[model samples]
Target: MARVSQEHLEARRRQIIQGAARCFSRDGFHGTSMQDIFRETGLSAGAVYRYFPGKEAIIAALANEVLTAVRGAFDDALAGPRPAWPDEIIAEALRRVDDVLLFPPALVIQVWSETFRDPRLAGILHGALIGMADAWAKVVASYQENGLMSADVPPAHVARVLLACAQGFLVQRALLGPLEVQVMSDGLRGLMSMGLRRPPEEEPGADAS
Candidate 1:
């Protein structure tokens, strides 16, 4: 038997994932068949199976990829150079949140809808989401340490609240018409301001006493 190189295996895996994304995004998970994956990838049935043991494996792989991408984006946006004013940083981060809401991995919604019916899958999805949220909370904590966050607010709690608002906006728009994206952006900004920006001291450059 010819030994398959690691690079070749990874490439094949990526091809399968891209094909799965296309099928899942268009026909949805339940609607898509293994045949759809084969057709989308232009690979033989045997080759598809060689890459992914089953359809469920493909779906799970896709979900992991999306979660990684989302987490990476959040990290980059949060760690960017601090803005001159605290509000500016909040605004940029809020905009990034809106961008995430606008276009997310199809697998995210797929796994979320199916999780409740399947306990094992629900556990997997929940773990992945909670890990991402925890990573995001750390970034929020940085601002708090720098005194950029408001004195009265809890950084971790605020991170959770902002993430929830972003997710809710996405859910609403998915069920409704092409509503304004800025609505989510503005709402996120308001939440950040309430919990992040410190109140100005009576005197400029003086710490709140």
Candidate 2:
């Protein structure tokens, strides 16, 4: 038998992954099955099985791919000459996700729901969140260095909040309808501009009377 090159093997895996993504995006995690994947890919059971044992494994692989792309977006923005602001960083990350994922972003909602039932999926997502959070922390630190953000608050805490904002954008887009990146970014910028101010009573020079 002629040996299959590594490139061919990788191509086949990508074919399977892309097919699975279509099925999952259309029918969702519970609705999609291994058989559906085979049909979608036009691959026999044994051929598909050779790459992934079941639908969950395929989903796990897809989730990892999507999350990695998002993280890469953050890394790319931070690697620029100047640190990107919160809105700029998130907008870039969102754009990267839109450009890179073979599946629709809405498919991530299904994956998030499946995480409750599948610890493996949850673990994969959790690890990705930790990595993204660290990247956001760097952004926060940069803001502090430039006197753009408060240095008193822990960067990690602020990072998680910023990460949540990005995740919230995905959730809103998935459920409510399409959302423009600029609209979301503008909202973030507006919120950040409302700098954390102390009340009159708490101001150092305020009169108690």
Candidate 3:
């Protein structure tokens, strides 16, 4: 047998994950089975098993992919040049979402739904949420320091709110179809950008209030 290079092994794993995503997207978490993934991938049972010990592993990988993408977006958006307001931060964040995760509305939704049923999945989801919120809390703190974020709200709470809004957008994509996702996403971006701005009652460079 030919030795499989790590690159080849990783590609094979990715291919299996894509297959599992298709199954999960079409049928759903409880509805999908390991055999279904095998059929979807057109890989023999042995081939599928070689990469994933079971369906849970496949679902975990796929779910983590979405989380990882979102985390990268959050980190990148926050680390880049400062936006003028919170909503612009959201706009930039959603742009990354659209650019990276929006091509298949059902896929992301399916991955998210799995968290509801599995404790392991819930852990992964919770970890991603905390990861984003913590990273973003720093961003919020910076805004507060710069007088960009309104002092009326705590930065940590604001960070959690932003993450909740973005996560809600993912749920919307699942509930709505692809066409509506684009429309809803546009609306979501608008909403996300709204409160992060300094109130008109305040001075331009006023101490946070």
Candidate 4:
């Protein structure tokens, strides 16, 4: 048999991953089987199995890819000349998620569900979240430096809160049908404006009654 080059091997593995991504996006993780992946990739069982031992492994790879893309979005936004606010960062990340061809945004919902049962998948997601949160913390720290955010708040805590908001947006988009990124951005802006205001109870000269 002719020896396969490393490039050829990597290309074939990518082919399997892309095909599996399509199936998972359409049929979901539990709905998709190895046979579905084989059909999608037009590869025989032996060929597909050579790349991934099972669907869980493929799901893990796809999840990592999606998470990496999200992190890239954060990095890109931060690399700009000016620091981005949370809403701006999220808008860029949403755009990146929309551009991901190998892994659909809806597939992230399936990955989240599977994480509870699969420790490996959970670990991959957990690590990605930590990295992304760290990136967000950098942005938060920048905001504080520029007086856009409070200096008293912990950057890591604020970062995690922003991360949760982004995750919530994803869940809503996946379940609630198509959502406009501008709408989310506007909502975040409104919430941020509200946050900046002093509460009625804290207002100066407010009546005690």
> Which candidate should be chosen as best, given lDDT against the real structure?
2
Better of 1 and 3 by TM-score: 3
lDDT per residue as tens, model 1, 16-121: 8877777877788889999888998899999888868777777666655655555666666666785223234334444554443223334456767877676766
Give the alpha carbon lDDT tens digit for every residue of 1-209 in model 3: 99989999888888898888777767876799888988888899999899889888887887677667667766676667773355555555566656544236666666666677889988988887788889778888888888765666687888887777766776765676544344545665577566655566685666766
Q: TM-score: which candidate is best?
A: 2
Q: Residue 133 of candidate 4: its Cα lDDT?
A: 91
The deviation in Å at residue 209 for candidate 4 is: 11
Per-residue lDDT of 205 in model 4: 82
Who is ahead in TM-score, 3 or 4? 4
lDDT of 4 by residue, 1-209 (tens): 99999999989988998899899899888889899999999999999988889999988877777787899988887899998778888888877777764454677788899989999999999889999999999999999999888797899999998899888988898788878888888888888887666688887688888
Candidate 1 ranges beyond 4 A from true positions: 1-8, 77-107, 176-187, 190-209
Model 4, CA-based lDDT: 0.86
Residues 73-134, model 2: lDDT tens digits: 88887888987888888888888778656677788888888899999999999899999999
User: 1 or 4, which is superior by TM-score?
Assistant: 4
Clashing pairs in 4: none
RMSD of 3: 5.3
Ten consecutive residues with minimal summed lDDT in candidate 1?
83-92
> Where is the poorest 10-residue window by lDDT in model 2?
96-105
